[model samples]
Target: MIIDESLPGKEECVGSLKNILDALYVLNGKWKLALILCLVQSSKRFNEIQNEITGISSKILAKELKDLELNDFIKRNVYPTTPVSIIYEATEYALTLKNVIGELSAWGEQHREKVKQSMRKQS
Candidate 1:
C-alpha cells in the first residue's frame, strides 16, 4: 500500500470507520448472530431459544438476550397467563441486518468448504 495522504474526505472515511466499529461492537459475540437466526423464524420462549441453540448456557443466553433488547435488535414480551410467559422476537429494526446476515452465511459456507479442501490436501 502506497501512502496517499492527499485523498479527499479523509475525515469522512474516519467517521465511516468509526460507524463500522460501533456496529461491530454491538454485534460482536459468538452467540448474537446465532440467537438472531433462531428468532428470525418466530417468537420463542426462553427455554425454547436455549434448547434451539446448542452449547449456549442459560446465563449467557439471558445476557445476550438483554444485550439484543438494549440494541433494539429484539423485543421481549411478557404475557399474563397461569404462568407468566416471556417471549423473544426479532424487531423490525433487526430486519435491517437481513442482507448482512445473508452475506455472512454465504461467506461462511464458502470458507468452510475452503478449509475442508485444505485439510484434505494436508491428508
Candidate 2:
C-alpha cells in the first residue's frame, strides 16, 4: 500500500483532528461561548444569566448550563434561601480558554473590517 507523502502520518493527523472536532462538538452552539464568557466574570443565578444574555430563552439557557456543567466547564451551586437559587460559575478549565477567546475576538474584529472593505468596494 502506498502512503501519501503529502500528508502527515494518519495517526498524528487523525488524532489531532478528532480532538478538535470533539471540542467543537461540545462547544458547538452560539450560546455556549457567550455563556462561558459571562460566567467568567462572576457566578450568576439562572435568571441573572438569562437577563445578561439578551436573546437566550429560558429553555435554551437551562439546556446550555446543563451541558456546560456536564463538560466540567462550569460549576453549579445550590443556595437554600426562601427560594432555592442555582448559581453557575466558570471553572478553571474554562479559564484555560481565555487565550482562545481573545484570539477569536481579535480575528472577528479583523474579519468585520475585511467585510466592510469588501462592501465598500462593491458599492
Candidate 3:
C-alpha cells in the first residue's frame, strides 16, 4: 500500500514500506529463517543441520544454505581433515536477527493460542 505524497506521514510510510520489502526480499522463504535459527544456536555439519530442521530435504537445505551464505548470513568453514570436514556457522550478521527471531517465536505461540481459542468458540 503506497501512501500518497500529500499524506502527512507519507515519507515515513514509504520508507517503512521500502525497508520491509527489502527485508522480505532477503528473508522470504520458509527455511531461511529456520535454518538461521538452528545455526545461531551452534554450528553444525550438513547432515546435522538437515536432521535438526526436520522435513527439510538435503537438496533444499543445500540451496537454502547457499542462499544464506550468499546473503552473508552464514559462513561455510572448511577444515583440513581426512574426509574434508566442513561446518556451517551463523555469521555475526546473523546474530542481529536474534531479537527478531525471538519476537516471531513469541508471536507464533500467541497466534497459535488465539487460533485455538477461536476454534473452540466456533464449536
Root-mean-square deviation (CA) per prediction:
4.6, 5.8, 5.2
Clashes of each: 0, 0, 0
Check candidate 2 and list the clashing pairs. none
Residue-level lDDT tens digits of model 1 in 9-70: 98989999999999899999999988888898899999999999999999999999999999
Worst 10 residues of 3 by lDDT: 1-10
lDDT of the structure predicted as candidate 1: 0.92
- Which scores greater on lDDT, model 2 or model 3? 3
Task: Quote the lDDT for 48 in model 3.
Answer: 95
Inter-residue clash pairs, candidate 1: none
Each model's lDDT: 0.92, 0.92, 0.93
Per TM-score, the best of the predicted structures is: 3
TM-score, one value per model: 0.81, 0.80, 0.84
Question: How displaced is residue 39 in candidate 3, in Å?
Answer: 0.6
**Among all candidates shown, the one with the greatest lDDT:** 3
